[model samples]
Target: MTNPPSLLLVLSTCLHLLQWILDKLRITRLAQRILLHVLAAGPIPQHVAIVMDGNRRYARGKGKMVQEGHGDGYMALRRVLEICLRLNIQCVSVYAFAIDNFKRSPDEVDALMHLAENKLLELCSHGNLLQEYGVRLNVVGRLSLFPENVQVAVRKAEQLTKSNNRSILNVCMPYSSRDEMTTAVEGCIREALAEDDYFTESITEDTINSHLMSVQRGSPPVDILIRTSGVKRLSDFMLWQCCENTQLHFSKTYWPDFGLFDFVPIILEWQRSVWFRRHDVLFRS
Candidate 1:
């Protein structure tokens, strides 16, 4: 029902808005460069786990639709991924969707699935930033439960980046710590039964680690776990991997509002911890 002139105007407005956003994002590039230089002086985390929460709440607070908030959250994720890639983080794991998240309203869940599929397809295409960075894509979870189209998209993404070896991006879609652990345990039992001495000789923590979805896909043990929207609990994400050695970070800011500034402090804390440990050892020796 729209006329040609009006449509052109709308398109122009959108283009201008997008350009403005791009400019604003670049405004932080210089700062990011300086920050990365500072970070290079210390050890960077090999594996960083993020529990992205509060999209619906962000939408409610801003009078926007839930899906809009999620879209913004996706944008935030892209920025964080860029930072991780720039910092040369070995493994970046994000909890995009949990198995229990299926309990959300059907409309919201459908929206999320569609959004995820579209974003994934876009990211998998050649010449994207992820491709440029040589970041391998691993969607780690119970993927069989997804819709056929979504599964296809996920497969395409994984196939597209399977050759990338520089860094890893683990999208924990519809994953559950409990389910992962149970599956690993079951697999171990099966293997033990198949091989008489396997249970007695081979089954150990490392064996179980080899069976976990993310760990098997190539992510290392989580060095830092962050939950946004001020959440303090692990919320069933990476429970086995986020052990005593892992630093836990809970930010008061909403996920969509979290940015480079918010994340830098957490990394700094981890770096400080590393330095302190090294200094204490040297002093004792």
Candidate 2:
């Protein structure tokens, strides 16, 4: 006859199973608690921007289709957005697609456009995550450049979330830094021409900044710019907003592989850099 398992052994096995369940379900909450504690100790970036790079490369490495990689990147984006909401970050901007990307093959560009349209529509759907989090969505780019259907979807998403004040999510698609600057300049010139004192109202930094895409939504300049996939370059992302004071974090992990835990060290590093800058310790004569 087989002996029954001891009570202590059974209790230990049950405890381990319970721990595994909590780890799978509440891991994000644990990370949020740690991040909150860190925020209490130091300053948190008011505006965080991401140059979500390496989706295609990540997919290729895994022997998957490029579109599949983009899908994974979208999933990673969703997770990061949740983290931002939990951390109470005021604004978060993502480089979804750029104007130069239109030069790609027709099929690829079409796929990307379709993806954007679907995502925008999903955000505008009833009881979407944006509504739950009170996050206002802003699509900043030349809307006319996109397909009519995409334009309509983008407008719908923006309009639906326009009143939410908990946070701002900026999605830059078909966007170019150079074009944004030119547009700002043109807007400033138009404003100057409208005024009686055209010569007196010179185009200044503030004038250009006021006309920038994000300014219309009242988003502040980006304080931290993170790029995944080991890329160090900005790739024409948020050139004006990520000013001299913005801290840059380059991660080796691909965007699809980025997770909530990945952000903890980045925030800690930002705090360290801010502390050094404030104390005038990092600069050398």
Candidate 3:
């Protein structure tokens, strides 16, 4: 009879298999890196806005509490912020809390406010990623709608990071696109009256755009808008800032589940569209 394989032979066979698996993994990773670099070669978007949605749904699906869902969503936001920094995106605006969200149950609203206050404090802390990445934080919504303490925390965060120049993070709290447009109109009228004691020049798109909350923070119009939870509608977020060419991406993944890998495909698609558009223009010319 053939002798049973020696212990040394079995051990060697296992080692060989392990080595092959490790090599395959390394090759796969290198291929992914190459693809990512190729997708990133085109014009990077200067500003990106995201509507972080479905925190409650995600929590319920996982048999967790709403607060836990919100907490997870916060962690996702932190990760996405880091990813934006890595991508060299100059500005990011998130639909954190809309004005209409006040219609939620009182306890839920209170929990959200508490979460926001704690996060603002954390963002303003010394040597946090906001500081490390030189990110300026701005609360781009009506401050009076929030609790006085929340307002104070937001102002403190904004003041602490105002000097940073590497990037801007705009948190939309108690914000509505209609309300924002109304506020911009009022601001334009007030400025015109202050300058000439009357409306001299006709109101133009630039007049309203210049007075917008995002514009005041020196952020350009949104280049791409990604909404989670499979939401395709704008939902009153950044109406004026999403220009005609703004690439809109909707991901079925809930906000709490979103990660860098979910975002990479969106960027790749946007880059492909940009390339096609440029080629079309060349053909027309």
lDDT of 1 by residue, 95-208 (tens): 999999899999999999999899998887879978999999999889998999899999999999999999999999889899999889788888888877654667888888
Instruction: Note the Cα lDDT for every prediction shown.
Output: 0.85, 0.82, 0.85
Per-prediction TM-score: 0.88, 0.84, 0.85
The residue-by-residue lDDT of candidate 3 on 164-248, one tens digit each, is 9999999988899899999999988888777775745656799999889888998898999999998789999998999999988
Q: Show the lowest summed lDDT stretch of 10 residues, model 2.
A: 2-11
Better of 1 and 2 by TM-score: 1
- Looking at model 2, residue 240 earns an lDDT score of 93
Give lDDT: candidate 3, residue 78: 94
Q: State, as a TM-score between 0 and 1, how close model 2 is to the true structure.
A: 0.84
Candidate 3 residue pairs in clash (backbone atoms < 3 Å) = none
Off by over 4 Å in 3: 1-40, 196-201
Report backbone clashes per prediction. 0, 0, 0
lDDT of 3 at 107: 95
The CA-based lDDT of model 3 is what?
Answer: 0.85
